[model samples]
Target: MLQIDRWKRILIIGLCVIGLAYAMPNLFYKRVEAHNDAVAAVEKAGGAATPEQEAAIALWPNWLPSSLVNLGLDLRGGAHLLAEVQVEQVYKARMDALWPELRRVLADQRSTIGAIRRVDAPDGQLRIEIENADQMSVAVQAARGLAVPVATLTGAGQDDLDVSAQGNTLTVQLSEAEKALTDDRTILQSLEIVRRRVDEVGTREPTIMRQGADRILIQVPGIGSAAELKALIGTTAQLTFNPVISTGSSADATPGIGEIILPSQEQPGLYYTLEATPVVTGEELTNAVPSTDQNGAPSVDFRFNPTGARKFGEYTSANVGQPFAIVLDNEVISAPVIRQAITTGSGQISGSMDYESANQLAVLLRAGALPAELTFLEERTIGPELGQDSIDAGRIAAAVGFVAVIFLMVASYGLFGVFASIALAVNMGLIFGILSAIGATLTLPGIAGIVLTIGMAVDANVLVFERIREELRTAKGPARAIDKGYQNAMSAIVDANITTLIIAAILFVLGSGPVKGFAVTLSIGIVTSVFTALWVTRLMTVTWFERRRPRTIEV
Candidate 1:
């Protein structure tokens, strides 16, 4: 009477086998990691592997699961940085872009508004002085016409630009609501760019997320140091091609309104004055790759999208025999003369860069530039040796807890306790297996969760065993007692586990970093423990009782 269906038994056994199979790779973490990395490299290289890669790939069987639970920064030892984004830069850039259009609108009504010139203001404000003081209203109206509704939900129907007039001067600045919306977008964009930059290097499990209003927290495992990580992402890499006004050797040279002076990268102290508005910016770039120029020197080739191509083509066609400055982060990389029109939408940037620099530049370009510059608020580098020590400590803690639980279960429940111990072992395997399958990262707190789970995994078994003792005292046969014991304990096991699981889910949803890691392990452990207790241990007990036909059992 106390029997599992054949299909259910097969399912349970199949799951355990699969769990073991997946968990096996973690035992040889380095070998399996090498194998996985090599495989990925070969795939990325279009099925070509070097001798070293081939050997690494052969370290593990091809048919088995090679995925391992990722180690978090605390366990893998890497770089940690808290950076505050210079979000005001975006506001300044936005105001700069709006200037040309605003000037054009006022220029169209020159007869009424009179001559207008841009006046210097704060970083994010645009101010213009008009010749006709009586026409200040007209200038303000023209500037306000350029205003667009904010795109954010909370700022719906609000104008992005706040325009006002004092005397003959008109001022335009971003509204408070729009500033808030821009801040959010800027931070989100910065986060994504940082993530892309990190992912380009193929590091494992980097924790990159927003920390607060204008900050991002970056934790990258396997990177050499915080400085290395910062260097990889710190460069704004803002590339632009602007029409050059003139070349000079003065570092403090003044430029006309709407123009900027940038130092040349190749020739120190040499500068180039260029138009503020770029012919084409890096945002329109579709692809970039490391390449070689006609002289066989390292360079980067880039292609632009349709809009960018049209703008670039028109600019080059009109500016033949003139030079355009290729600027990166406000520094002139090159000021090359345009001999002929370039309409192919593709161009090359060649400078005093080697292949390594060219390749890094290409990677950065492909990943896109950060929306705003970041100021590092804090930085730290963790060593691999420390991570190993933490791993060792966690292993000892889990093993000690596991052994104690086994000893208590076996001593208290006799043969039934052995079944529980076996189930507990299976439960641990299943947790790791699920973690590997899901590609979750394991942190120090996650290890503590696993240790806690080792103690809790036996609770359901204890309840069932106690209920069996009660049933046996009522004079029920072994089979009937075992069946009633499981049935009576099922509700309590489900209730307790479900409540704990709800808490785990809440923690996972609301918590960050280590808390989420703990919740992840605990949640996985709860499910596996429940399954092993109600089904796995019961199956073992029913099989033993059937084989032995025990007339009576002792608790």
Candidate 2:
């Protein structure tokens, strides 16, 4: 241990230098953050950033280590929302979507099954009464043909649709396995939409994640309020293209089956009678952007995917001169007359929107529709003042803890204790350095974890030092004693730190929010502390001893 290998010494010094270099940016946190934001803005603006943003970017040099640890919501202050996704809404949509395909399939065999009429059923259930009652078995068989096998691990070979025949009617609904799949998809889609909307607002480090089976947890750091966040993500943005039957002042004008009346969003009191099934939905949209029409008015230009383009083109070519409604959330936003078939797969929507609303609609369309509406179950806004208070308190506690630990170590072990103290400081620098590199969020509980780390960093040093004292009684030279001490205490040091690390890993896996924050800091600190205590202090001690050639050392 006294005569260390050349590569091991280089590794120890290299790690220490890297740690301090990465930790240097945190000393000027605000300046570094401003620089990062400016760089991001410049990149987003196609390299044409404002003069002020350019000046901000110049505050920090590009060649240096620029990474900083991410601050958690409690540290930076922002909005938090707990939302439950209404998965049942997707069920109703699925049933509505299923009707069109079911109709087309059964209509192919109209001679055999006669006529098929939709009957009233529950929200997710589809019931069809066969005009020829004796041919109900044929209708059921045809509906069952629509059932496709699910591809999920647990849902393998499970039918997507459950079709049953009862008397003269056939019932069709999603199977239990299919509902589970739908719920999973709905929650995941909701999480992605919330993330996209929050990211579009340019907020820093937003945590948009799925909470439970059908819920989402959104925490945006450095945002204004929960209401602002809600405004960003609340819109369902369910845009649909429906075939219009007729337009009238009264909603009761169209009494055809599978037809309903909806009030126009643009023109109040005017209603449109549209088919229950839409020609195409927003799900088919590949891209949407805010652009100007030929008249230079703000409009949303959209492009459809191949499948949607084919469907829309077919509908348009067959129904030229007929009006179709661009419905948004069950309200007719626009009823335009189809002049020519748009085989190009791109179209523009001109409406009563200003630039801002048009831009918002473009963003919503680009982000795609939420699978289900999110009902806000809980909301809260964290103020920046409170975050500052937390910072101040944590600063004081960490400083006091560091100073107290340093004093106690120096008083007990003299020069050897001072070596341990230096290792302790290096341990902290490395922890923050790792956190910054990984972009881990530091919460209030994380600060506590740091303080806890400060206290525990000396455990290995204490064990080794005591062992040195025991070895000094048996060994002839102080150098021999020191080498024996490290080897003897190695098992105990590894056991204690590894056990703590196991607990930290468990917390990280099973915990959420603040608990996760604690786990992250604790886990980082353990690895750094062990490295600093063993290699760092040992390196410092052996170098001093070799340089001075101390025959009898106090340590």
Candidate 3:
């Protein structure tokens, strides 16, 4: 180990330089973070960077990597929320939607099932009573014909809807297979929408994940409280194009068989009777972005997929001069008469929107509608002062641990102990460098892992140095003793590190939140300590031996 090759020397020095380069950003943490945030903001707006932000970014060179360590919620003081998606709401919605389709289909064959009437039913069931008793079989067969295959791995080959008939009354509900598919969609869509809404605020390292069948876990670092998060994701933005049947202020205005009355969201006491079946929904949108309308007012520009575009174009051409209500979450956003057909797939939404509200609406539309409303099951707030207290405590613990380890190592083996202490310091720098590079979140538990690492980092050096002393007692020369010490201790060092690595991997896979964070720092520290001990310290000693050629060494 004392005999170092020229290639190994270059490699070791190069790694040290690279590690320091990455670690340098954390020293100027606030400045680098502001620069990154400004860059992200400018890119999001599709605008040029301001002079101030550009100057801040220029403080750090462009050639060097810019990633910094991401602080966890406990460190940064942010919002935490556990929201449960009301999947049952989607079931009722599905049934309500089925009423119109069932009415239309059974109406086409009016002679068979005469005077079909929707009666009272349970939450997720559609109950239709036919005037003709013997036509129950005919109604069941028609409803069953509307069934489609479930589109999930577990639900494939099963019908999406179940239809049953008894004593002239027909009942329809989602099959078990359809409920499974709907639950999956609800949770996944909720997760994505929550993530998009948080990201639009330009916050960093927000954790949004699915917890169970209908629950989502959201932890956003740097936001003030759970109420702010709720406000961000509260809007549904479920836009639709429904043909207008009538306009009135009467909230109780009963409608025709194919019509429903809904009040406008912005306008109080204004009701609109619109066709139950929509021309298209927000789901068909391919893109939506904040923009300026022709009148220079803030608006949202949207583009539809090919299918939606085709349907919209045909509908507009067939029903020229007719009014269509632009509904959002069962409320009318606008109802304008169609003067001419819009052949293009793209259009803009203008409703006296200010810049901020327009941008928020655009983000919600881009994220797509959540499958169902979410109930806030849990909420929390972490103050920055509390985070600072924890940080200060952690720093004190680390400093005391470092000093104790350094003093003990120096007292034990003099020059060799000093060498080990130097390697240990470099080992820590490497750990920070790796964590920054991987964008790992640093929590309080993570700090404890690093302190633990400081205590354990010198084990390899200790084993090697003790073996060197044993060799010296056997009458071997200093150079030969050092070489023998490193070679003989290699097996124990490798075995110990490998075993620890296996445990860290298990913790990372099985544990949650802070536990995973601890595993990350511990794993990174182990790899770095092994490199510093086996290569870095050995290189230092070999260079010293080559230059001084000492006849007798204290180590």
Q: Which candidate number has the best lDDT?
A: 1
lDDT order, best first, reads 1, 2, 3
Question: Which is better, 1 or 3, measured by TM-score?
Answer: 1
Give the residue spans of candidate 1 off by over 4 A. none
Q: lDDT tens digits, residues 90-205, model 2?
A: 89889988898899999987999898899888889999989888988888888989999986988988999999888888899999999999989888878888788778868877
Clashing pairs for model 1 are none
Clashing pairs in 2: none
Write candidate 1's Cα lDDT for 470-492 as tens digits: 99988568888899999999999
Top-TM-score candidate index: 1
Candidate 3 versus truth, CA RMSD in Å, comes to 2.4
TM-score of 2: 0.96
Model 3, span 1-555: residue lDDT tens:
468879989999899788878888888888888878777777876978889878877877778778898988888888898988989988987897788788889887679879888877787898888889787888888998899998888887899999998897889999999998888888887888888888877788888888777888888888988898888886777888999988898988778655789997667888999887788889899999899988898889999999989988999999999997888888897888999998798888888569998888888888888778888999999988888888889889999999999999999989888889999989988888888998989999999999989987999898889888888877568998889889988999999999999999999998878888999999998999899999998988888889999998887
The lDDT of each candidate is 0.93, 0.91, 0.87
State how far residue 65 of model 2 sits from its true place (Å).
1.2
- The CA lDDT at 97 in model 3 is 79
Q: Please provide TM-scores, in order, for all candidate models, with all chains considered together.
A: 0.99, 0.96, 0.93
